[model samples]
Target: MMARDPIRLWLNAHLGLVYVFLYVPILVLIALSFNKSGLPTAWTGFSTEWYGKLVANPKILSAAGNSLIVAVASTIISTVIGTLLAMGLEEGRSNPWLDALVAAPMIIPDIVLAIALLSFYTLLNMSLGLHSIVLSHAVFNIAFVCMVVRTRLKNFDRSIVEASIDLGASELTTFRRVTLPVIAPGVVAAALLSFTLSIDEFIIAYFTAGAGQGSTTFPMQIYAMIRFGVTPEINAIATIVIGFSFFLVLLSQRLNREAAP
Candidate 1:
């Protein structure tokens, strides 16, 4: 039997510690979701009471519905615009200003953007509701979607597109039948990632959601619950949100990997 190297053993130990440090709290939260006592300190026994309560909570249900609406709307807008932007930018020679402008949303402080957007809406007298939230979410979602699609496009074979054009296909036809199919996986990945981000976003949504429960999203509800205090139901909801985000991100990663080769 081969002996393990000391350096490798040490590195493995450190990596394990890092992983525990990052995920221990999440694991605890998930475990607590099944607690019968509804207290973090005492687990009493495992039960699905919290999950049942989560489903029965009208406020939570309403907020979740609103979040779904915002996520779907933002994902659709972001995917379409972001994919087109990536294709347009990639087709042309690199322009530093354009690149910076495209990336600005991802880098800018969320709070700052949120406030600026809120102020702009107020100035224009635009009503604050689902539409405003969708628009606000789309700004960052577009940046993320564009970045993901652009990464896929960077490895794209442009020769195929040129060949299609050379073979008497119009540019639109070539893009539709040839280029799009190749990038479909990347598009799906980007849309999923954008939807996840939009669903979980709070700071921007809080600022832009304006005055009412009508536009309250799931994250906003979570924030309110956290502020009041932690409860078993909150734990269950958190577990669900975390699980959904993880699933979407994993799917995105898988799609991107599949698109690669």
Candidate 2:
């Protein structure tokens, strides 16, 4: 048997504590979602009635639909724009200021970005709705996607691109056949990350959404519900949302690992 390393053991213990700290509350929440008692400290029994209520709630259904629309639309737009932007920047000389500008949205606080977006929209007299939320989400999503793709590009082999071009293939065709395949994993990861963030986003959506029930995203709806205090139904909704975000992030991590050299 090999000798045990004290440092490794210590690190493992620390990591275990960190995971417990982060996920114990979420695990408790999940358990409580099905609690028949619907009490925080006591668990009478397990029941899925709250989940059924979630399905029957019209307001929640509408808000979920709105979130899906914003997430899908923003993911598509951000993935395309961000991928192209990352490619452009990678092909050009490095500029620190330009890099910072590209990443500013992700670095800045969400509330600040939300307020700025709201101001910009009001100044332009743009009608606020799901579309507005989509646009605002796309702003941060683009930055995140760009950052992820850029990491993939950092280790990219330029020779493949040059070879494809030298074979009389047009730039677009080369990108479709060669460049895109190499970066496909990163693109997928970025898209998933964007979708997850957009779906869970509250502040930006709250600020940019129109003044009506029609524009309420799921997170916004959850916030409104929270004002009335937590219930089994709210717990169920939170569990579902947290589960979805966790899944997407896990998938993104997997993709990123696959893309690693």
What is the C-alpha local distance difference test score of each model? Answer: 0.94, 0.94
State every prediction's TM-score relative to the real structure.
0.96, 0.95
Q: How close is candidate 2 to the true structure, as a TM-score?
A: 0.95
TM-score of model 1 vs. true structure: 0.96
Clashing pairs in 1: none
Candidate 1 per-residue C-alpha lDDT over 68-161 given as tens digits, one digit per residue, 9 for 90 to 100: 9999999999999999999999989999999999999999999999999999999999999999999999988999999999999999999999
lDDT of 2 by residue, 1-261 (tens): 245687788889999999999999999999999989866547899899989989999999999999999999999999999999999999899999999999999999999999999999999999999999999999989999999999999999999989999999999999999999999999999999999999999999999997999999999999999998888778899999999999999999999999988
lDDT of 1 at 77: 97
- Give the poorly placed runs of model 2, Cα more than 4 Å off: 1-10
Question: CA shift at 150, candidate 1, in angstroms?
Answer: 0.8
> What residue runs in model 1 are displaced by over 4 Å at the alpha carbon?
1-4
